[model samples]
Target: MAEWRDPQWEYFAIQSLRGKSFGDEWPTIPEFFQYTVERFPDNSAFTTFAGEQRESISYRELAQYVEALARSLQNLGLTAGDRVAVSGKNSPYWGIVYLAVLCAGCVVVPLDARQNGEFHKHLAEFTEAKAVFMDGDLLAKLEEAETEQPAYRKYLIQSRKDFADATGAKWETMWQMIESRKGDTTGALSSLAQIRSDDMAALLTTSGTTGNEKLAMLSHANFTSNLIQCVYPGLQEILSTDRLYLLLPMHHCYPMTAVFLEGISHGSELIFPRGLAVQQILQDLKDGKVTVFMGVPMLFNKIIQGVLNKVKAQPAAKQLMFRLMMGISGVSDRMGKAIGSKLFSGVLKAMGFDHIRILICGAGVLMPEVGEKYRRLGLNFIQGYGLTEAAPIVTLNPAGTSEVRSVGRLLPMITGRLESSPELSAPVVSVRGHEVGELCIDGPNKMSGYYKNPQATAEAFTEDGFLRTGDMGYFDRNGYFYITGRSKNVIVTAGGKNIYPEEIEELFQLCSWFEQVMVRGYREDGTEKTELVVYPKLSEDCVARIAADRDAFLSGDTVKDPAKQEEIIGVQLHREILADVQRISRKLPDYQRIGRVRVILLSLEMTTTQKIKRFLAESRFAQHNDGLLTESQDF
Candidate 1:
């Protein structure tokens, strides 16, 4: 075939690798890593902050470690295309094992570190993983289980001597494996030549809590193409000097591809925070001089709220000055100049966000107000939209030209269209000049298919080969995309109008008291109407305010009876939150207005990725009676 040049793949760093390690197609993950090592041998690759000290590794040193581990894995009977699962917290060791699995020509399955042993066992058995590298605590859990364990070989991610001394089990550790094979020449590097860009590099499960987990098979081309699409043509700019922060779990594709792989491909230093603690993150941000930070919407909201709460505590004159500076910053940013950082230099330094150059949000929706606030603070805040099925990055809002209302512009070489018909399982209708429909994408970034599930794979794509994203959305006139909600969460009213729960849920974000909220269809007088289930933040002040509102009911008998006090608070909270919802829903069409509300004292269950598990919440609502509102209490 004649050499094909894709403008997207022509990113200078990728272009430098062409005709060498990479061909006309994208390079395998290992190949790209090697290219980076060769280009920036002395550059710091990975660093982990551990309390008072930090551990760092250079690109060359990381490559050496990866190759040694790869040789050891090959010697341990794992060959090309074999499955190996790695489960651990975010650390340099986890990164080494992940790269080593690919270097050994095996498919790396990065398991969620937060999942229990049973879930790990299910995943191992499903993927037929021949070997597993896991944290010591997780390995112990797997062994202590009374049920039969999977027959795969296990290697501890901890020290061999420590784990053996603690558990009296003689399992080799990753470091031991590497030490035993040090300086021993193996054909692992030679065999890596056989790996192609189309080969599967990673097998990621989209849904694992359910027994029917859909494993998305992503090829080398899928991820590398995504990296190219995101880095070039003004999507996101990253340089070798940039230090990327890794706070989220590495098993999730968002952090894996966006921060880890993208950082390595550009020879940028990746800082692994000690933990997700707010103080620890702030310290790491300041100490590591992190330039790029990526997180979920919940984390961003909490940070922004923290900043605002502190600002509100300042004297009236200082608060007014802050507001004036913010207005000036917003005006300057809109006119192609940004002076917010310079104006709020001291404030940024105090908040630990002084060194941050770019803030990216993914894996959930970010309120427009949050994005605007960050930009007003002279920070580059942008969000992208993607799922595990699409190698996880479909569109990224370019910095400086960001649109707060839209997710982002579609990446180069990626084609997207909306389908509104019987073919699409969801009902999509025209709304506000843009036809709301299922967003289908076609590009190199799309996954190969669901592994081992031919029927599910067949249903995931359209006849012309666009991956059906299962997200109902529309594109604005300026080529920006807006996602309303998931197709499965759509609510149909008696009037035959479609209401997306996500659209309704977004309205609740402005309510600071709501820690979490979910919108769903409920039966009201034999008609389906929208109902909101809110888990409010019971802060000291919030509780005092609630008590003040129900002063008449909380006297004598009610005050003495705990159950009665609880009941009164729940009822009054329902009314207050419902009133706010009514005020907000008035802007929407009549059919979409919320007709009922439920206030639950307990917080809603959240996934490891910080997403509300709607189905799980519904299951709990059906099974439990604590604080759950009955259908008879409809407004």
Candidate 2:
């Protein structure tokens, strides 16, 4: 009950807003932006960075563009409630289009531009979108396919290029449309006034990483409320002075609400990297002085891993010194002193993180070690948990008093309960829980329902109206939630033990030899057992160590034939990996321990967010030969 109280920072954050009008929440996202634009008209709202060059639009300037574009859409025969699809890479222009559609009182359907034509086509037809604003290249792909396009009444290009010649149609560029209608008279504002807070604002498709796609319907209140929820819980300190980095795909809800919407709502500068390249992001981070960085676990792990790898390559004395410094920083952390920034100033500057105020990871499981390493390095790092159905933000670790082991404490005003029952519609085998089970949530930020799929909408919630999160997790005594794994991904062993692959996969993440890892249950001798499929990323040191073990195994009579070298290496690799697996498995419960191990050279198939597609991974490698270095089970 103590955890259910209003967030401590809410009063302070709300009072700071102009006239303290946004105490609970704004009626709509448009109204919130309107307030911000009026409050910080000249403040930089959106910025795009490309190496040393950048472009920006102030809040006032962006509002003008949004108003013009909204009028342009209305003039082009679009009306209120019309579905408009917007697909593009992350950019200020993309944000403008998204806001403009909402301004026109139309539902914004944010489709994944990285998806293939068929995928785009399916979403368009599924939503029955009346118009589409697309990037030139993706539009070209649809035309190149020679298939009938989705029934779109108007096409607006996101790129600066006029693709009339290429497409044999006079498609208007987004900028051209906005500029041409800047002063044009329209009734768009009137329609926007009529748009209700409960109206469906955006139709977002759930990432089918688990191989299932459903369109989620989120409302204006959902988006607006969630942004408030994101802040008051911990990030109320973020101000107009902060620069929020947008690295993850903006089409996804995680970055959309966390970075894009959060930045603009706070009147902060929203910085978009020119490209997703690590170097490009680093350049932008340093040059732009971004204060907030929100990214997925994969990207964060890669970044932290790169840093640790460099430290590991250092001389023994230097490596030990670095650890000592980190330990010192950790002590300072517990003492409520932030000396990591001072302690690791050189390291921070080198990694372009010297100016970064907050580092947040979400969208996938993050190893606790990774989270601990970041804090010890003197960074304000936090992890959060959410799904699209919850307007994508259910919880955020309170910045100053974070519980790194848990995903985060529930956002202010969100109520959650754990239910232990496989009979529920959750796609899990054993919904185990005396303490852990499906996490069900209820809050104003929760989505209205799945788009047009009544059955799924019905199944997605409980009789009491709490949305079934389909994630297996439990709350700590302090209300911080720790996710075990997805309900759908639970592996039930023959001994009636449940194995959460993500939990085991995190242990493997601590090992430098693995690029990626996925655990699943396999049948052996008419009984279910744990098996591991891994993509190895052996370091030079790892190779040398394994080679030494191999030579010792053969009593210094190593394979002489060149052809046999590959065979010898393969056997040695399997033995080394298995030994490591056993070493790590000892920490896990006996039933959850891996019995068989398989090594694959080729990378596993992954979603754009870098989550390994579990179903696809299992089936794709089922027949591959050399990729599989199977070891006999002894567990």
In terms of TM-score, how similar is model 1 to the real structure?
Answer: 0.90
| Every model: Cα RMSD to truth | 5.0, 6.0
Compute the lDDT of residue 16 as modeled in candidate 2.
Answer: 62
Q: Once superposed on the true structure, which residue ranges of model 1 sit more than 4 Å away at CA?
A: 1-9, 12-17, 159-170, 185-193, 207-211, 421-428, 539-579, 625-635
Backbone clashes, each candidate:
0, 0
Give the Cα lDDT of each candidate: 0.79, 0.77
- The residue-level lDDT of candidate 2 at 137 comes to 74
Pairs that collide, model 1: none
Query: What does candidate 1's lDDT look like per residue over 1-635, in tens digits?
Result: 02224455445556675786677467888878877887798999998765778778898878877888888898888888999999998888889899989988999998988878887888888899999999988887767752764678998886324544564456778877777776874323424537888889899988432235688999888998888778854667888999999899998888899999999988999999877877788888888989999998888888888788898999999999999999999899888898888998887887788988889988877788788888989888998999888888998998776467688978877899987644333344677878888899999989989988999999899998999988888998888998888777778778778888888777677676678888878786788788778777776764665556443322232333435534645556655666676677778788887776666655666766788878777776676543434333223
Task: Report residue 547 deviation for candidate 1 (angstroms).
Answer: 22
Estimate candidate 1's RMSD in Å: 5.0
